[model samples]
Target chain A: MPPPAKIRIDLNSAVPAYRQIVDAVRVLLVEGALPPGSELPSVRRLAMDLGVHFNTVGEAYRELAAEGWLDLRHGRGATVIARGSPAARPEQLQEFRTRLRSLVAQMRSEGVAPARIAAELRSLTESLKP
Target chain B: MNSALFLSLLVVAFTGAFMLLVPHFSSPRYLFAVTVPAGFRASEPGRAAIRRYHWWVVRAIAASAVIVATMAQSWPDLAVVLAMLPAIAGVASFLRERSKLQGYAAPPPGVREADLAPDGDHLPRWIALALVPLALPLAAAAYLRAHWSEIPERFPVHWGAAGEPNRWAGKTPAAVYGPLLSGAGMMLFLLLLGLAIFYGSRRAPQRTAILKILVACVYFLGFIFTGVGLMPVVRVPIAAFLVATFLFAAAVIAWGYKIVTDPAQPVEATLDQYWYLGSIYCNPQDPAIFVQKRIGFGYTINFGNRMSWLLLGSFLAGMLGLVRVAR
Candidate 1:
């Protein structure tokens, strides 16, 4: 078996610390870094190791929970739920499309060409490949 | 009690309370954790993103360790303080991410822009809260300035360092010039930072030019004071002046940057991009955590370096004085 999934963060990124955590956890779930049913380090343990606030780690885990990538129990820490496909409720799917469209529009307003945006999406998909 | 002293005491007490609250609130989350398996089975782009973030985080921690170690030998006290640096940064990131994830309510189909902007703004309150910490520090500094002589040249006897006491020689040439120039540099630094922030908040196009000028003024005056002390006739004072200059430069740069960018933006992060970037000194793109967005900036990193360096310079001067006394 591959080594246990270790989540790390970059202090210098333009992303917010909590967002970075969410993104990192998301990537782990999508890439099979942590398979479905895999257990994650306690938010506190991860926070301590990463030298971040426990809240920051907790927030990341919460994000994953919302996305259905991880299951958080009251006293059990976080466990992997769905690995590759985040279970999407019908309402959630609709919301996702709306958010995605607005996000794209925001990019376009900022002068990003459609081709470039497409490339970014393509890159994101490619990165998810197992 | 003096208001500043009272405030300072209050801050210490609050910080202590915060520390205690940590484990109580975080224990459950720490005890049980979960993660989805990576797609090594079909390894997709999503997997790479997570892997990348992991790598980046590792690198950031490693670099922080090296910096702390290298600077420690020269400034042991500062080094110890630096130890807490990574922990603060890491935790901040963790909490932020967790909150975002928790707040995630998948957008409903055709969700409008109006929905994205939550009603009854939460951001303003948070910003106000952030400003609260600054108040205590500023109040204390202001009080000290108003009662400069009462501020005590040395800290209380109980808190004194382990080494031999280094008292300022009465009526020394260096002592006269050292404080004067250092004080001036401090004032200039504050002015520049204030200007940067003030200008940045406005919509005027000329604000950028004003910021550039303010920044330049800080750098220029800082060196000027140091250079004045370096003159053959003023060598003794030069050392102290340089220490002050370093501090002034760091503070201005840190606060100045905050005036320009709001860390609240959505984008990739670099350590320098966030308003808080000064909190952690090194770059955040290390390989331990990869595929992360741009890093946010924090004042702790950049300002910490300046504060540490200032103390170091002061210590060096004290040592030199002791050597002269022996001679």
Candidate 2:
């Protein structure tokens, strides 16, 4: 097996600490670096490692649990779960649409051509396929 | 003039002298335990800074030694404490450099992620058995039994700084054997503590040094404890004891320093901000019970780990028990 991948976050980043942890763990989960049934570090341990409050890690773990990526127990701690994809919802797509529009606008402002933007999106979608 | 005074002077002198070498105990390029990019610590300007630091430490040690030699006969206890100034100065330099190095060097590469694994690095389990000989204080106790008739009805159990026996204990078996028994108990306690530290450390180099020091201490303490316990009976000269103790200390420090600071074993760290005031390490993610000191030369307990606390508590209790037995 490959060496275990690590989740890291910048304490000095503009994003909130909890959000950084949530995002980092989500990326690890998506990339399958943290396999299903693998245990997450206890909230207190992660908080101490990140120099953040216990609630920050607890909140992040709760967020991941709500998103169906983890199972949190009162005493046993958090564990990854084999999460199937959520059903497509138009409301979620609307949120994605707004996010994409802002991203595309930012790229355009940076002088990226519309054709180049569309090509990059097509490549990302292709790469996502198994 | 007395055993207590000699012991005090030796402790202070040894501690202060060891303090002089503390800064050089870590990797020069990396900011000691934090492992930040200390480009300046290895640069021309950094060389000047290090030179100045060393110059001050030398002065502190020299002054402390002079004072210790002079006042040890008078105010022995105070002289011992005063002798700690050099080591204190060394720590001051370490912290000063840590702070200054932060500004002069780039910020630390923060929040490192390490693969959590149990890697035992080929150390044999039999190495721990080196502590077995710490039980030698018992032999001294046995000798006291053979010469039981020679023991006076009332003997000097404790002494003052003026070379006079101050506290007397009845020559019962309990009083006769107390110090040696305490020595045996203390050695046993320290052996357990050392083994815990050896197994608790994750870094291979640190573990190697911890093993050497712990094993070395087992033998060193065996002799020291047996000698100390036998001192009142055998009437050993204070000066001779001091010289032997100093040699043992020098050997232990030299050997440990050589191993732990071996350029081969550089300790790595991350999220140093959690290292409260750059001293106390509170990393819960780290599995090791003992970690290399971020600023000093030896092992420090991980305050975040519950097991570290338990170890500390038990060791302290053992120490108190040893003292009670000696008293």
Candidate 3:
């Protein structure tokens, strides 16, 4: 059998651990790495593995569950669920555009060429395609 | 040669050799329990520390052998203390070396990895074998009750190196049943320890290896103490017991050495600052109650964790209860 999907987090990163966990799991979910019906480690187990407080993993799992991606049971651990693709709202699209523009501005400020940035954007978009 | 003196010398030699090999048992990323860069153990400073540590251990062993040989006949009780010289000296040298190597301590790895799947948490089926030894003490207890008339009014409970009874116990209920009860208690304690290591520590191959050793030890304790309890009604050879114990211990140490020295064994990345004296691990931020030991083959409790205090407290209470039952 193939090995289970893994997630890595940098404890020294500027982002909070819960945010990092949420972002990493979201990426895996979108990339089809964590398929529906897949089980996630228990909050306590994941917290121990990450060397973080139990509440941190719990919070991340709660966020994912709220996003319709996970089902958290009392005794059983978190499990991935098949989430329906919701129609994008205009406000959500605007928020995404703002974030993307800010990221592109930062990249240009760091001396990235416009052509290189466009190429990188095209590669990511291609990867996101079904 | 006096058997006591011979045993003392044997212990000294074994301890000396074991202590000398201690530096090689741990991961190469660690020197004297302090985390170092890969291949640092072959560095000039690392070689010097190991050489000096060995020098002190050898001296301690020679001194212990002379003491045990000269003092065993006159003061057999002190022979046990003499046997500890190598370990005491080895620890002192190890700490000194660790302090010097602190300058070269590598940065603790900041990234942590974990699989989303939670499948490996179940205990191995062979762990059920630990339950099998629980019956030995129970069976001995049953046999003792049935053969009560055969038990003597007084029997040897302790023996000297010459196989002579050093202490006797009256054939009261406590005296007859204490050893069996204590053995059962010890077996239970070891089983609990094995469970704790399986559940409390991070997933690693060494965890299962240590658990297997614990299961074996539970079996060894069950047989040894059952034989002790039956000594009043049966002729049990003290020498045979000693030889068996020696062989069992030798096997355990050899197996443990092989597992700990395996390069593929994953070593936990713990901050050096959290480890006091390079042995006692204390990290409040770590959620794990047990962490892998840098100095030994098994897991050690994180003293800084609150749950660890509860475990330690319970263990001490259990030990006290065992002592009471034995008395």
Top candidate when judged by TM-score against the true structure? 3
Error of 2 at B43 (Å): 3.7
TM-score pick, better of 1 and 3: 3
Q: Chain A in model 2: its TM-score?
A: 0.85
Candidate that would win on lDDT:
3
Residue range B1-327, candidate 3, lDDT tens digits = 887887788788888888998888787778899988988888898899899999999999999999998988988768957888999999999999999999988988788888787876999998988899899989999999999999999899998755579999998999999999999999999999999888887777888999999999999999999998888898998877888898898898888878877888777768888999988999988989999888867789999899999999999999999999988
lDDT of 3 by residue, A8-117 (tens): 99987899999999999998888788889989999989998788889999999999999999999998999999999999899999999999999999999999999999
Ten-residue segment with the worst summed lDDT in candidate 1 chain B?
B109-118
Please state the error at residue B255 of candidate 2 in Å. 6.1
- Tens-digit lDDT string for candidate 2 (A1-118): 7875566777567788789888888877876777788877677555544545678889999999999999998977788999998886999999999999999999999999999999
All candidates: TM-score: 0.27, 0.68, 0.95
- True-contact fraction per candidate equals 0.00, 0.18, 0.89
DockQ, per model, reads 0.02, 0.14, 0.84
Per-residue alpha-carbon lDDT of candidate 1 for residues B63-158, written as tens digits (9 for 90 to 100): 555665565556544544554444454455444433333322122211101110111111222223222333332343344345555433333111
Off by over 4 Å in 2: A104-130, B1-17, B27-37, B64-85, B88-110, B114-169, B180-292, B299-322
* lDDT tens digits by residue: candidate 2, B127-170: 76775775577678888888888877886765555456677888
- Each model's chain A TM-score: 0.67, 0.85, 0.92
Native contact fraction (fnat) of model 1 = 0.00
